[model samples]
Target: MTKGIQNSETPLFLLSMMMENPEAAELCFPQLLNNSCRKPLPPQSDGMLVYIVLSFISLLTVTLNLLVIISISNFRQLHNPTNLLILSLAVSDFLVGLLLMPAEILHTEACWFFGDHMCALNYVVDFIITSSSVGNMVLISIDRYLAICDPLQYTNKVTLDRTKICVCLCWICSVLYNSLILNNFLRHPDEQNSCYGECVVILNNITGTVDFVFTFISPITVIIFLYARVFVVAVSQARTMRSHIATVALQRSVKVTAKKSEMKAARTLGVVVVVFLICICPYYSPTLVGQDIEDSSSSSPFVVWLLYFNSCLNPVIYAFFYPWFRKSIKLIVTLQILQPDSCNAGIM
Candidate 1:
């Protein structure tokens, strides 16, 4: 009969050996071995400090994402097509920080305290949120491409309805990709071999190579290609605008102003793409060599921690790329500081 929960036999053996066996000569080694073949378990390596740091970072990310979401959503003037994409990204990141990270931290400590159902649900939610986040970044790239390359066409075609449709499609595609993983693959947790964490991979017949290919490699390829094209289009558009202005040779002041504005817009999109690449590369880099890692479960913290960096970055990127968010923050701060006086006036 199936136990319907992860078997910790493997980890127990590993953890036990680590804690039980201690060699002074081996203690001189720089690395801690979570998995060793020694008959006696080695000393228990406490990951409590790591978990506490991760939890703090996760809490900070959640708070920032919430502020971003609320700031964007509450400001009526910021309800444009591009900001819509930003808001979607915020929502996905917020869920990662709020819902996923806590569970992950707990699992890191307790080694999967949740049962099978919870595990499946956690995996599904994680897949959905992560996939959606990647998809949203793609959507943002396309949106910026249109805005920079074909300004007039962007104004005409990038309507609110179209933006909504794009976001909906992003989420749908994300859910579909995750669905593929769950349906074609995924195994019941092994009571002996597995941890009780949510979203723990059922490492069986399927290789990490398969997971890396479908989940990381494919999507990353798409993102890189899209951003490349977007950059090309943006550069071409900027050159075209510059040429047109040079030919017309209107007033010097007007020409300079137009050139500066064009340059500014191009620079904004450039920075956004660059930031996207930087933030996502760390998280996905492991996917390339994930199969080679000696201990997959223990190495997961590298990717998980890198992913947490991504959740925190989106808010900072928005604050940098979009001035509206900064203005909104200033407004919110000023209003909060004045609320008491306004209340007193109203009461009087």
Candidate 2:
């Protein structure tokens, strides 16, 4: 009788200890005992809700970006220097949907099961995608600036071949820049880690500041300045065109047609830039506050998701603004793309 009571009490004590000590209660590697990180254990209901919502977002991002890729790549009419930049941006966004979003979901809700090397590689990839996306936006802004602010010079200056080269250089520079920035972390992923299950990379203050300026401040400044100039010129042109409407009828009509086309393109690309800024600003809020930029754990998941969600939104913008995108989607959905000479089909 005494022995049975003792055994019952022992089990109860162990259970109570496990319940009290959160770290011991849930571990990523139970066998490691003291070495492993505690696994995050939010309430089951909250966890389920987050997973369902984020998974849906990830799926939507993938689908939307895939459609953009198909639309721009398949239509010969859509092939131009400006569309090439859009294609580059879409590819970066597609990769974010494909690789980064899912990985982020797992990082937020669970433990790092893929080990340290993978963690380093993941960070490297993330940086590359981010940098490339920013570069493409800069290129898009410059393309619009030249088209709107200097219509005659635009044709000679921005050709398809030159745009293609610029796109290639953008990607290559992103890779090289991120590789240099993340070299230390990539070399020693576990150097700063306190436990087995968490994956984190930290940059020193100087490096963080430099990255913040180049990645966030400089690009944003350029974008805003170029767009501001474009706006002023656009308004001035509108006023001039209205005033001279009666004087230069035939010649003005010809020039007005071209100007209208450029203005429309400028307006659409402006929307894209505005949306990009909205999504990205939150992700960099920490840096703005002088905090070290730690992407995996220290950053808010909502901000991170918002940034990733921007990729998903770009194609939706295109669909709403560009009739060609809608028509291409219909063609793609009906499996008409598989037909011969479909690329020559009138999309624009």
Query: lDDT: which candidate is best?
Result: 2
Going through the candidates in the order shown, the clash numbers are 17, 0
Error of 1 at 188 (Å): 2.8
Candidate 2 residue-wise lDDT, 200-229, digit = tens:
888778778888888889999999999999
lDDT of 1 by residue, 1-348 (tens): 222323444655655554676552233111234421112223254555666678888898898888778776766566778778878988998998998888776555443434555666776787788778877877777776666555546668889899999999988987876777665333553333332222345433354456566656776677677667666765664666667644445434443553465445445655655665666566556445543322223446666667656788778766786676676666566775245433222110
Residue 347 of model 2, lDDT score: 78
Candidate 1, residue 249: how far the Cα is off, in Å: 11
Show where candidate 2 strays beyond 4 Å.
1-25, 245-255
Model 2, position 105, has a per-residue lDDT of 84
Model 1 ranges with Cα > 4 A deviation: 1-49, 184-192, 195-199, 203-215, 233-273, 282-297, 333-348
Query: Per-candidate RMSD vs. true structure?
Result: 8.2, 7.0
Question: What pairs collide in candidate 2?
Answer: none
TM-score for all models, in order of appearance: 0.70, 0.90
